[model samples]
Target: MEFRLLGQFELRDGDRGHHLGGPMQRTLLAHLLLAGQAVRTTDDLTRRLWGTADSSTSTLQVHVLRLRRLLKATGCSATIETSPGGYRVNLGDDTADVTEFHRHIASARNTDDEVRELHALDAALDLWRGTPLTGVTADWPRFPEVRALTEARDEARTRRAELRMTLGRSPDLQDLRDLIAEHPEREHTRHLLMWALHRAGRRKEALATYEDAYRYSVGQLGLEPCRQLRELQHLVLSGG
Candidate 1:
């Protein structure tokens, strides 16, 4: 069973999916699953569920009980255990999509083989369906933790694009352009776009990209380009 919170909240066991009840239940499940073997304190969970720490702990227990009943009804192997301060969700052999995404990224980075790294990065980005925790709403999704997943997804995209260019694959230049459009200040990805442009024989445009970035930094931000960007521009200028 995979608890998918990558997009919509769904308990996917094979092709069949167990209905995860209402928003509160979905948010609670998202919290515990994201905790990933760590106990989420009762107080922390209450604040997430109700947006205030004043909610009754008994209410939380009711939701946990309902979740357990749902698990038993579906015969899922996942277990929720109560600890001294809070609750922990054990997924057993089953995994969550978020866990798989992180694992894929880690595997990619640890690999020296560029082709293998590209594939792993692809897999990691593919796990995202849409904005994460789309259905799991309330205070939980509003926090930086959920936002971090989206940021990680964005980085995975840029990394994959960089790796593809390194492997001599014809990168989607438009992807890099779109990436820069969204994150002009992201020097690493901008470097990637410059490399892709240089490789594609767009030497003038590549230099112009650096110029545009330079103007943005010096004029708007009153800062110079980083050492890496300057070196890249030097390499591009000498046709290296």
Candidate 2:
């Protein structure tokens, strides 16, 4: 049996391909995938899926039973194993899109070449088409998947900034400005934009970009730009 969570959550058991749907099912599967070879307790699963609503352990067992049957019917070898307190999904290849993304990112981290790292980071970012769990909001708000996706996106932004600096397109301020406009809370992108503007001999415009970014960050995220951004802004203003 082959399980895939890269684009869509899918299970291929022999000749049959099963598309897993429903918010609860997706949440259950995602929770299992994020556990990383550990068995989750029933209480934890219930809390994650149903929040504070009073639910029985039997309810979780029923859901697991259904999921196990569904996988079996699909001819996949995936088994939902029952432990003393919880359950686990054991399948081969372990091909999850989220996992693949992290693997690529970790591979990019040790490389010295910014161009190649940027290419790999972009590919990892491309795996995310939307929110981590589309149509599934009940349980995802507190899940690790959300945090993982958020960090991956931020890492991609930082890598892009580094790549742009390495390419030395000082006049590439336009797109960097656009990126900041789209993600004003991303101070790193704004920092890179400021540098690009300064290098292009548009010192005043660069300063303005910093001002705009500062205001946007304070207003939108209720936070200030990072120290690096502040330092860059000061250097630009002082003609350093």
Candidate 3:
């Protein structure tokens, strides 16, 4: 079985997909899956879900029971095991997308081979469907886990683009442009966009990106870009 938490909480046992359940149930499952074998104490979970509300233990149990029944019905190998004070999710022979994503990223980080690392990054990034925990409320005090996942995704994307440039691969200019447009303050992606434009023999456009970035930084944030960007602009100006 494969449990995907990068987007909606979904379980796939072979070709069949299981809904898991509604918002609260999905949130419960997400917490358990992220906790892995580590026991999330009953108090901790109740605090997260109910926040000092009265009569939460039985309610929490009902959610867990429903999750277990759904897992059983779907033939998923994962089980929600009861610990002394709380529960733990044991994946058995199953896997979670978040785990796989992190594993691939770690593999990429550990390898010296650029080509191999790039492929690993690709695998890692492909696991994301969209904004994580989609349709799940950010209201569980806005899960830090979800925020970390998004940050990981952005870092992976940036690293992959940098790797492509290093390997002399054909730069995806449009992607770089899109990234910069989304993050005008990202000097690194601006650098990347300029480099790609220069390599494509559009030195004029590359220099223009630097000028635009300069104006944006100074006008909005009262700060200039880092030294690398300025140096790259000089290099472009000199036709180097």
Which one is best on TM-score?
A: 3
TM-score of each: 0.84, 0.72, 0.90
Clashes of 1: 0
Candidate 2: stretches off by over 4 Å = 1-17, 52-54, 112-116, 137-139, 167-186, 197-207, 217-240
lDDT of 2 by residue, 72-125 (tens): 666655577888888876765435566667777976887888777877877787
Q: How far is candidate 2 from the true structure (C-alpha RMSD, Å)?
A: 4.6
lDDT of 3 by residue, 1-240 (tens): 898878766787777788777777777888887776689999878877776645469999999998888878878788999999899999999999999998999999999999999999999989988767666664632667666777788778888889998999866677777777767888998998888888878989998999989998999899997898999999888989
lDDT of 1 by residue, 122-208 (tens): 899888887677766665446777878778888888888877877778777887888788788888888888888888889999999
List where candidate 1 sits over 4 angstroms from the true fold.
Answer: 139-142, 203-208, 227-240
lDDT of 3 at 67: 81
C-alpha lDDT (0 to 100) for residue 61 of candidate 2: 81
Candidate 3: list runs displaced more than 4 Å: 52-55
